[model samples]
Target: MSIQPVSRERHAHLRWKGFSSFAFAASTTLAPLAAAEISQAALALPLAFIERDGHWSMAAVLGLMPGQNLYVDAGGVWLGRYIPAALRGYPFLIGARADSEPPPCIDASSGLVTPGEGEPFFDEAGSLSPTVTQVMRFLEQTAQSEATLVDACETLASFAVLEA
Candidate 1:
């Protein structure tokens, strides 16, 4: 998959179509959760703290093993009331860079980015459209919350309240 940063200069011509299925997340066993959504997500999904490269974050446990997600059915539909923020934003992601804040990116291969179709990322004036603006804001907020989530999880681990 070609994952590239989104910018008015590069992605201005691209259009974004909404995710049609949870198929993209069908193989994911753990979906990252922000601190704000932890309570709601835990109501329906088993919550667990996951560690990557020694960084901790809370996540929703979707299955017992890797490449399996019990919440997503054979049809790629998610059978849950609260979709994790990570999975909710399909094709769009916040990418981390050295000494910089995360940038919003797109999974170009997800078939969600198209030319002359769906909602435009930018308007004719080369500015973010309303739809893209809302999505970008949500992604940025989620990224910001990730730090708090990590701190909280680390605190939980320190208290011997969480298991990776």
Candidate 2:
């Protein structure tokens, strides 16, 4: 997915309209299934712990092939207790910049972004609107949580607990 940095200077007028359907249009599977809290995932979707390339992770099996998601219906409605945070934070993502800390970016292909529609990204005073701020916070928290999960996985691997 092509992601561009979200900037007031570049996207001062762009607004993010709500998504009309499930945003996992690019993948059939969601992996590394760690969230801010992993227990919350168990209450919703079934998870499979897997080891790949010497690293262990979890995944939620969504479907059997590309373009098919069992959790979403034909009308693009989600039919699960919890949507994956990775998917929920779609269009908006944390990506590393060339010379600065990672910044929140927007997927250009996502139809939610428009010039004159939906919720305003920035207020009249050139500040982020509540929606944008919330998204940014979510991305930041998700990144930190994912890092913790990775560290935990690595610790387990160090103990020879994960099978390759």
Candidate 3:
């Protein structure tokens, strides 16, 4: 994916047609779960604790093998009743930038993006559109909550309360 930070200066003309399929996420074997949505996701997915560099994060196990997602069907549809928050925010991500709150980014190569014929990123007033603003807000909230969950998981690991 050609991920690039979104900015009015760079992508004012770009528009998002939105995606109709979950196929874009089919390559992943795990999907990160936001704390707020974990209960719902757990009802439909097996929860797994992923460890990296001694830090822990919770995710939904999508498949047993690498590069495979069992929840997404061959037709590009999601089979689960509760989708992970990380997968819901498709083509958009909160990119980390040093010490600052990360900026929202988009996959410019995601076919959903276009110069015309979709939801515009910026309005004629040169401000972010309401839709874009809402998406940004959701992405920020998801990232913040997931970070908290990761910290909690790391603490649990440190105390030996969580099993590998």
Candidate 4:
């Protein structure tokens, strides 16, 4: 997916329309896995824990096919107890910068974004609205957790407990 940095100058006038269905996720082959520290909270869910290329992750196993998600109902609604934080923070993502802190980025193609509709991204004062602030916080936490997961996986691989 093509992601662009979210900035007041660019996105101030836009609104987050909110996704009406899970069709976008249903079409994807895989979803982002929770970090090891947070995986236990989702253990009872229907997803499967998988480790690939030294990265410990999870995947929703719908069927025997490559790209299938059974959790998606007839109306494209996800039927699971815990939604992956990655998916919950739709459209917005944390992107690493070359010489500055990572900033929240938005998938330009996501249907959740619009010129006029739904929750406003910025308030009348040209500042981020509460909804946008919450999303940014979620993305920040997700990025930090992902980094920790990568480090933990690397350490495990060094000890021969995980395969690279």
List clash counts for every candidate, in order: 0, 0, 0, 0
Candidate number of the best TM-score = 3
In model 1, the Cα lDDT at residue 95 comes to 78
Q: Report RMSD (Å) for each prediction in the order shown.
A: 1.8, 2.4, 1.4, 2.8
* lDDT of each residue in 1-164, candidate 2, tens digit only: 67898889888878887677874443556545655757887788777666755666676767777566788876778888877777777778888867987877888788878888888777888887888889889888877887777777778878988756
Models ranked on lDDT: 3, 1, 2, 4
Among the numbered candidates, top lDDT falls to: 3
Tens-digit lDDT string for candidate 3 (25-69):
888898887788888887889998998656798999998999999
Instruction: Evaluate model 2: give its TM-score.
Output: 0.85
Tens digits of per-residue lDDT, candidate 1, 1-164, equal 68998898888877989998998888899888888888898888998778966977878999899999998999988898889998777788877798987777889889888887899888898877888778878988887787889988789888888775
CA displacement after TM-score superposition, residue 90 of candidate 2 (Å): 2.2
Model 2 bad stretches (over 4 Å): 50-55, 65-68
Predictions in order: lDDT:
0.85, 0.75, 0.87, 0.71
Q: Model 4 TM-score?
A: 0.80
Candidate 1 has its poorest 10 consecutive residues by lDDT at: 48-57
- Candidate 2: residue 150 Cα off by (Å): 0.8
Alpha-carbon TM-score of each model against the true structure: 0.90, 0.85, 0.94, 0.80
Q: Which is the better candidate, 1 or 2, if ranked by lDDT? A: 1
